[model samples]
Target chain A: MLSFTFWDILSNLLLAARWTVLLSLIAFVCGGVVGLLVLLARVSRSAVLRKLSGYYIEAFQGTPLLMQLFLIFFGLPLVGIEVTAWLAAVLALTLFTSAFLAEIWRGCVEAVPRGQWEASESLGMTYFEQMRHVVLPQALRISIPPTVGFSVQVIKGTALTSIIGFVEVTRAGTMITNATFQPFLVYGLVALIYFVLCFPLSFYAKRLERRLHVAR
Target chain B: MAYSFDFSAVFDYSDVLLQGILMTVQLTAVGTVFGVGLGIVGAAVMTSRSRILRVIVSAYVELIRNTPFLVQLFFIFFGLPALGFRLSAWEAASLAMVINLGAYSTEIIRAGIEATPKGQIEAGLSLGMNRVQVFRHIIISPAMQRIWPALSSQIVIVMLGSAVCSQIAAEELTYAANFIQSRNFRAFESYFVTTILYLALAIALRFVLKMVGNHMFKRRSHA
Candidate 1:
């Protein structure tokens, strides 16, 4: 059996942290796109789209992301669509992020005041034009803070993907502890890595929020 | 190959699933109670004039909030034993959940505290109310009223996060799912059943929490 030193363990876990960062970026970007589409449908003039997207958000929101990950990782194989852990993780997390981002973005959009919507309509602009030119520009400014805040969530969420067998930092921590027989030091480092990744975003999000609050 | 779905194996594990659900409910209930209590105290401490206490509370909130809950759980369960404290999986899970929930609800409740108008607190003070009286009567309850929805959502998120406790073999709902899958080799079917149960639990929890919030805060209605 090979005995691992603190530096060796830290260096190995540090390498694994890259995957965590990559997975979070992939999930956040993909989820952001899906969430925008959901936001559009959720706020559109068509009642059917509105209702369907509403349920879509609810179904994702009302379930645990752990369960979603299991279903995607385990359930898809049963249906003859075998997915790698990476693929399944991204799919489940993207849907999860879409739901939350859609909800948050919709709140910002609605906060643009009802008069903006009516004004855009009265200007005879198409629905897409209204959103592209008017609604999103204003809403995007308001959306930045919460959206950045949610990125912290997406980063934390990548930790759960480790359960399905993708070796992110937390999974790497477990494997290292088993090897080194030092759970305290290993898991503490794992947590510190996550803190390093997440705290700056949280602090910036708070600053943005306060700036917005002061502006309002 | 067209796969015909079979759920018979899942049904065979129904009793196990029920026990898992019971344990989950117990863990979540206890975690929420203690977590919210910590949140209340933490929020107060976060806002107090004692600069050291304030910095300590803020550091706790930032550190916990930034890290993943699973790592936190592993630290409590595995790390503590090395430091001369051995905890049962249940004890470790509960403590981790409580601490995690506490850090979160601290921020949420602190927001509510900050949102309390200065006029309201001043009014209480001018009306011959002491600090404690004004805090209890004029500040805390109203702040809770303002932040109830956020607090409720955080509570539910922690409930869902409890699913991770099964990793440490805490016998929660996900643990049951894992157990059934191991027995029947029906991973898909078992997880499907467990997923629906989780969805149902989340919905039921949200409803129950909302009702409790409504009942408690109804009399404080501004109108």
Candidate 2:
């Protein structure tokens, strides 16, 4: 077996970390877009939309993301559809993130007091107009910390995509460990890189939370 | 062209799936007990007066919380052997799970601990309860009572998360699905059954925990 230097392993893992970051960003952005729609549906006056979003959240959040990925990865091929690991991972993570982000945002939107809603209605605002002018603005401020906090979850979650043959940092670490027989060193470095990516967001989330409490 | 779905291959291996479900439930039971025990200790350390302990606890929480559980599992199962200690797949999986739950529950339980009003602790002290007694009797129950819902949900999350332990060949439910699929070549059917099993487990766990919380959260006289 050829020996890999410390730098060789670290550099290889760092390159793979790019995919990790990219996957997280794509999933986060996509999930955020879908999550907003779910949030709107959840708060809409239509019982069907509200209940539909509720089931959407429960289905995604209630199950493990690993199974979700596996289902998409294996199940799609049965219908004569082949999916690359990248596409499968994106599908799974986006659905998973949407459920969580929607729920978090829903909590914030609901936190806007009843008086605000009544006042908006009295001002001859339509449902969309009331949400746009009054409710969403107030909710946006409190929602930031939790939304940022959930982003850390999104980043960490991208690691599961590794199981489906995606060569993100975790998979790369496993591959390198196979090559170098240094699981401790390789996996330790992998964990550290994830921490580097997640900690700042987590810290900022906490700061935002504290600020929210003070504002309240 | 239409392909018909086949689940008969998976149902033929019902025994294996049953074994997998039992193993998963057993792992979660052991995991929940030890994990919650460790979380109580970690939370206590976090809140204790020692600056060194506070630093160590926060660092432990951050490091675990920020990283993925799968990597942590790999590190324990594959790494620790090189460091002189060897762990079986079951041990490694359980340890990984316990460690994961401990980190999460520490912060959760600490939030519960912190939510205890200062006057309550002082009241226990004035009643001549020792610090240990105060912590065990006065603090733990109400604190647990308050956070029972969050703690139970965390337990269920960990239960669901335990599916990843199958990656290490722990013979959990997901592992059974993999094994059955390999034998029958019915990958979709196998995983579909396994996924439904997990969803059922999560829902069942939530239901049971809600019942448990009802009993635990009942108001009792502080006296």
Best by DockQ: 1
lDDT of 2 by residue, B95-190 (tens): 988899899989999999998889989999999999899999878888787788899989988898888898899999999999999999888889
Chain A of model 1 scored by TM-score: 0.97
Please state the CAPRI-style docking class of candidate 1: high
In the range A1-216, model 2's lDDT, one tens digit per residue, is 678999999999999999999999999999999999999999999999999999999888777889999999998887888899999999899989999999999999999999999999999999999999999999999999999999999998999999999999999999999899899899999999999999999999999899889988
Interface RMSD of 1: 0.9
Candidate 1 runs further than 4 Å off? none
Evaluate residue B72 in candidate 2 and report its C-alpha lDDT on the 0 to 100 scale. Answer: 90
| lDDT top scorer | 1
State residue A32's C-alpha deviation in candidate 2, in Å: 0.3
Q: How well docked is model 2, in DockQ terms?
A: 0.84
DockQ of each: 0.85, 0.84
Each candidate's fnat, listed in order, reads 0.85, 0.81
